[model samples]
Target: MIATPQSCQELLAHMVGFDTVVAYHSGVAEAERKLSDYLAGLATAWGFTVRELPIEGACGNLLIEHCIDPTLPWLMFDSHMDTVGVEGMTIDPFGGEIRDGRLYGRGACDTKGTGAAMLWALREYAAGSQKPRNIAVLFSVGEEHVQTGARAFVEQHLALLDWTPAGVVAGEPTQMQVLGATGGFVRWKMTTLGQACHSSKPDRGHNAIYDMARLVTALEDDYIGKIRATHPLVGNASAAITVINGGKQVNVVPAEATITFDRRLVPGEDGQRELNAVQALAAQVAASRPGMQVTHHQFESAPPMGTVDGGQFANQAVTALEGVGISSEVAGEPFTTNGNHFAAAGIPTIVVGPGDIAQAHTPDEWVSLEELDRGIAGYAAIMKS
Candidate 1:
């Protein structure tokens, strides 16, 4: 059997070697399977019981448990296995090369760095004589795209567990700081339909592109501008039209046009309510313009995370960072993480890890060794607490 990783850096290198970008579009499935196998081996060697919870075909979530007593409150450390697609990357996506105290790879900074740290902390806890609490490490898949892995774990595995966790620390790039809250998101597509005709006879057909332009303007001026309330940490709720597609040809009047919108929700904001408001606006716009049909399809609505447990876990996390000599303040993230799903499951969740968010999903993604070492220490401290 392959030996367990001796250190956090070694484990991170092994994790970066896997090209576990999501399947279908990327068509690569071996990376997640291989990484799961590696983690299972290490968990088995460390005297932990490992369970592979099946997600979509061939993709699964790995849960490693080190339980000293059933009565003790369990603490869960979560991180995703999949990384964003490595298209247009400057460095080798799976190279796992270390240079100038930085590790270069796709998942190095975004998540695998924290995954390694979590695993290392678990290993250390298992080897140590004093067991502070029961621990469970979850390495989930499909975090970058749909979050199928995390959702499945919550609905399937977490419900089946005998004990509820005291808290959950989701692994994300936060420069070794604790994230107390984060903005959630709602995304959808709005489409306008009209009749197609020749450019020379443009007056004969209603232009879908023109109809969509009016709809966009209405949303920006009416719906988005009306959001006055703001979360203390994550700032005001915001909306933007991210993608738009229209004309089929230069000479033909387009018969259909579509635009995609992304709306960020602050804590205490209802994502479904916000989406319903948009749909209402779309219907109003369509009714105002004769022959112009506007329709929207809701794709996703992820709830915003809040410090619902009265900040006990946040305080413990802050103390953990301070013990490691890492200067960190409780903060909020503009983007969501797997923690959103966990928080939805009634688990007090926080996002903390190494590296910077700016480097994630970049052309030459990298994480500094200094921050990685600090992350390992911080996670160990948190687990012990």
Candidate 2:
């Protein structure tokens, strides 16, 4: 059965019904497990073999496989099962309501729509008389938060495949365009310590907030532009102090201050080296201030996806999209995705799918019904190409 816009929308509604938000971020356990099981069931019913890659303390990933020609190179499609929190949603986060030719839900655009399209494409191809290259669909978890599912897939399960992948298409909200490259991320915490005193006191104690103010000022004025590393596709690296906390009460002078530093790394830039540079600057700031202490702790780091290695696969994807009557082009984005992990693992990969990225994580998230139909056809074309 060929997939249609109405069928895609129905499947998307069912997918959106599952509250697959990452447990790490939402404090909800097995957030993706039910959806993984449900999707696995669908794949099994469609005659595709399914394997579960368990992610410790989380739902895990689903690998749905279908092979036709063993001698032919395999193609992989990856889409995350998890969505961000629905804290400020204006519509029903799980309703999957269709209004004005669009489907509304938390993951409607950012990517359950892609997931449904992939599933339908696989089903259609498997049921049809002709089979293209061997296919695998990986539904990964934790993409909205730490991306542990993708990392685990690359580190552990990727070697399990019998055939080398010709290319990997990572499903992101790319509006059917091919995202050839994307920026990376490194986040760490910086802390400043000082003596505590009453707010009314006249220079009785050092203010940690004041010290942190100087460090932030230095970062904004001196350090931000210093990230000279530039990638031809994703552009230059950048950094910002995203979160800060200092005082506990209005009348008390704070003794400690902490700020979270988030740095975006372009391809060819080292994440640890970026963190080290920030720490060095913090050390300099601390040395300049008398009786002040500054410390740092690194937390998250994700490598960037580069276009140079994935250019061929991206072009293939562009051709596939163009075949489906969509105007597609290879592009770059400042945001990171699971494609980074896949590309880092030496699999030529591109990020592409239906819907506008601007709709992702918005209060009224949506994906157009027409785009959903195109996504099914586009993914099916790539599967056969």
Candidate 3:
């Protein structure tokens, strides 16, 4: 068995040494296997039952359970194992180098920092005489891309688990603040069709690119501009045309053009409703231009997280941080997380961790050692509370 990690820094160092960068489209990788094996060994050494739920070929989510009593309410902690690609990283991506009181690596700030803190807290709790609350820790896979691991856990493992959780805390770069609300999003593509003809005789054929441009302008003015709904914490619902592609050679008139949209939703906004609205807008634009046709295809939709502010779970988290002499406030995040899945399943969820979201996917990502140390105590205190 691998030696037990004595501190958060040591655990983070060991974790960052593995290049768990998940490749797009292709999911299989050796780094995730090594890291999962190391984590499983540590959990087993600490008297926790470990189970690996396969998400794909060799990638899976690890569930570490320490159940003292089935009657007690269980609390779940979650963090992701996969990191984004390190193609343009400035420093060695897997070096785990510490400099100027910060640890630098790909997943260091995004989640490994939080994961180390969670493990350290669990270790400390298992070694102490105090009978902390029953807990389950999930190290999920594919969080950086599609969140297949989290979905699998909720759909497959949640029903199979023996205990029902009272609450869940998802690990993210929240700067140690409790996030009770977060935005959701939907991504889709729109295609505009036209007729192809000789460029010299432009009057004979319609240009798809020009039709797409008109559609974009109409969407910006009529659809996006008309949205007046807003949320207190997560701000307003918004939409953006993120990607556009079209055309062939300069001599040929393009027959088709496409654009992708990223639409952010607040708590009350329904993703399907929003998609229908966009489709209607596209139909309206197509109708305005004779002989033009537009089609929309949706790719993904994640619901916004809405937990009661200052409720039991949030208050408990705040009290835990305060017990450790760390001051924090409940806030909202503009981005979606794995917490959304749990919250959507009717479990009260909070997102809290040690780093800033700004540094999550940067070139030289880093997390403060001081914050990580505080996170260890904070998480332990939450369990104890």
Per-model TM-score on C-alpha atoms? 0.96, 0.94, 0.95
Off by over 4 Å in 2: 1-6, 200-204, 308-310
What are the lDDT scores of the predictions, listed in order?
0.87, 0.87, 0.85
- Per-residue CA lDDT of model 1 for 1-385, tens digit only, reads 7656677888898899887887644776544888889889988877899988886564789999999998888999999988888889999988989999999999999899999989888888888886889999999888887676778878887777787778999999999889999989999899999999999999988899999999999998999888875888888889999999999999999999999999999989898888889999999998999998987775977789898797788888999889879888888977888888889888898999999988999999999999898888898889887
* CA error at residue 191 for candidate 1, angstroms: 0.3
Clashing residue pairs, backbone N/CA/C < 3 A, model 1? none
| 230-256: candidate 2 lDDT, tens digit per residue | 877788788888899998899888999
Global fold similarity of model 2 (TM-score) = 0.94
The lDDT-based order of candidates, best leading, equals 1, 2, 3
lDDT of 2: 0.87
Candidate 3 lDDT over residue span 173-286, tens digit each: 888898888999888899999988889988888899999999999999998888887888788888999999998889778899999999898888888899888898899889
> What ranges in model 1 sit over 4 Å off?
1-3, 28-31
Q: What is the Cα root-mean-square deviation between model 3 and the actual structure? A: 1.8
